[model samples]
Target: MIYINFNGSLHFKTDAIFTSQNRFAFGDGFIESFRVFNDKITFETLHENRIKASCEVLFLELEKFNLEEEVSKVLIANKLKNARVRIHFFRVGNGRYLPETNQCNFLVEAEDDNVQAFHLHTIETISLSKQYFKASHSLGNIKSSSALLFVLAAKEANKNTWNDAILLNENKAICEATSSNVFIRKSDGLLLTPPLNSGCVAGVMRQKVLQLLQQNSYQIYEQNFTVSELENAAEIFLTNATKGIQSVVKFNNKKLENNIAIELVSLLNKEIGL
Candidate 1:
């Protein structure tokens, strides 16, 4: 279920509707995040930065949208305290391949999300599918609406009873999961995540985790790694804005140690004051 606010006014929609000729309906849309905390929105700057970057990549105008104000209005009108809100921007006008106007229309959707952080307790996540095409360098990092690949992977995960599936890159390097960034804690106690070149989304939580790790002098590296490295790791975890740090207790039949994940989750929650 979703509560929607279109533009500035309170609006309700039975489902997301777009014209047949709309670029967004044709898979050309973008999504941004706004996390609500204590009746106020947090990480406005980060969200704005990401949105601006996405617009630049997609050639959309950012000057016409007032996202910050729209988010505040939606939260207040809906009487929400803590939640995960998504602002979806899409081209509304018609065109064969390109929209007549790049002008974007947005719909703000909010859902109840618990405030407490969580860690994954399940062991042995399934491998959904082999890597397909590489996400283009110009468009890879931004969370644009180009979601067919992710949608299919997520569907497979749900169907297979897997918590999440690991995605590989065109080169067969471990990229990320369906909706979260991947991390591995080495036997010697170092952390590693896929580099931007690996086609993983530059997740806000992933960025925050890297910052916190560096601030605390923990050894961290960003590079392309393979599934073999994952099987050899002492610990595995996933991170996103919604879930913070979730330990992947097992991948297939292998059980992973949670010692580092536990320590990091505690430290990260404190660092972010969650």
Candidate 2:
């Protein structure tokens, strides 16, 4: 039997914590996901800060609740040492489009994972998503539950038999991948990723990668670029909290390299003491 933590209380996964009235009516909530390594939550401080920012954006008050302790309790209850943990925070009261209360409730779920550390993996192929585009807005930076754009982009990728799809912003500039931040390396060894104004999620791993690159004195820039620029890249990588770095082997017919990505994985593991 699997157990989950709902608003600081333990219950079976089958238990219903919220009803239709108070549930996530319009997908009005946000999520935080991270990996737990050897019973420790990786990047705990970053995750917590992101959660706090997300709550503030949605006007949900945490009010002295201990998120880290709740997560630890869920991990202990599930007996999971290495796991993928997700926490969903939603407003508690309901009132059509506008919520009646700013108070929130959360559910924590943890599942066992096989990966013990960050590793480099190559995506065989990826393509630009043509069907949908992510809107460039402040809300786009939040990990909100309403992710239909990404969901549709993933479907488009699967339909084309591609490993993943690159999503463009409404302005037709590169934003991010289906579920990760996009990065490209030019032949001259310069790294480029879309800025927050380009409507990409403020990914924790993306932040860490930028810091790592700067610490190592690598040239990197966060600026908007076109598809033509991406096609000319010598290497392309996607980063998220769960998957450290994933290199794309092919984009359209262009072959890419993974040398930098592989090196970053080593640096990341060492920095995390993994």
Candidate 3:
């Protein structure tokens, strides 16, 4: 009895809600995904704000709809407790490059998930992506449906037998990983990550982790750096809403430590009351 919420209504998962003129034609939308643990949507406020901000950027009007309530409906209909929820928001109308209306339609879906709390994972190896570079533009910060850059980068990483691929901006500065925000920890206990201007997605988990680091009196900086700069880093980790923290063990041939990441996981789970 899989169910989905489409434009404020619940329907079977197989219900058709999009036309070729909409989603498939222009990829004219954005999406947000987050975890639900113990019947609670983690960071619900942050996710709501990000979705609204992204809709504003894309000119998709959400009006007065309640996001959390809608997601709850889908979760309840599907009888899910711990789950991975996704919301797809797209403009509805008739037009080419220009949309006929700014009104937005959204679809909410949830799937059962086994992960109940944030856990630290290890990546054996990672490499820089050579085929594509993330565009250094404001639009790059939005989680738009057009994600070919990341899709190709992930494919390249798998083909090269690397755990993941690091994406660089047009300026040749480290942007982020295929699906997570990048963080580098120096031997001196300093933390560094690419600024939003570096063309990295403004990840929700990245925001929360930064806040936690600051509260714990950790020195952190949102700055752009090149791969050469990483040689001096003592440790590196990636963060995203789904995975929380993933420590990278090797970059090229240099082995990195995960002491800080391991500590952060415990702090993160505690902060979330998990």
Best by TM-score: 2
Give Cα-based local distance difference scores for all models.
0.74, 0.89, 0.89
* Tens digits of per-residue lDDT for model 3, 1-274: 7999988889999877666766446878888989898888888899988998998899888876797789899988988888999888888875798788888888899999978998899999999998989989999898888888889999999999999999999899999999999999988888999999998998999999899899989999999987887767899999998888999999987999998899899998898797
lDDT winner between 2 and 3, please give it. 2
Residue-wise lDDT of candidate 1 within 156-237, one digit each (tens)? 7777787778888778888888777888988888889999888888888788778878888999999887778888899888
Q: TM-score for each prediction? A: 0.88, 0.97, 0.96
TM-score of 1: 0.88
lDDT of 3: 0.89
For model 3, the superposed segments whose C-alpha errors exceed 4 Å read none
The runs of at least 3 residues in candidate 1 whose Cα sits more than 4 Å from the true structure, single-residue gaps closed, are: 1-3, 15-18, 114-124, 131-136
Best by lDDT: 2
Backbone clash pairs for candidate 2 read none
True lDDT of residue 132, candidate 2: 88
* Model 2 stretches astray by more than 4 angstroms: none
Candidate 1 vs candidate 2, TM-score winner: 2
By the TM-score metric, which is better: model 1 or model 3?
A: 3
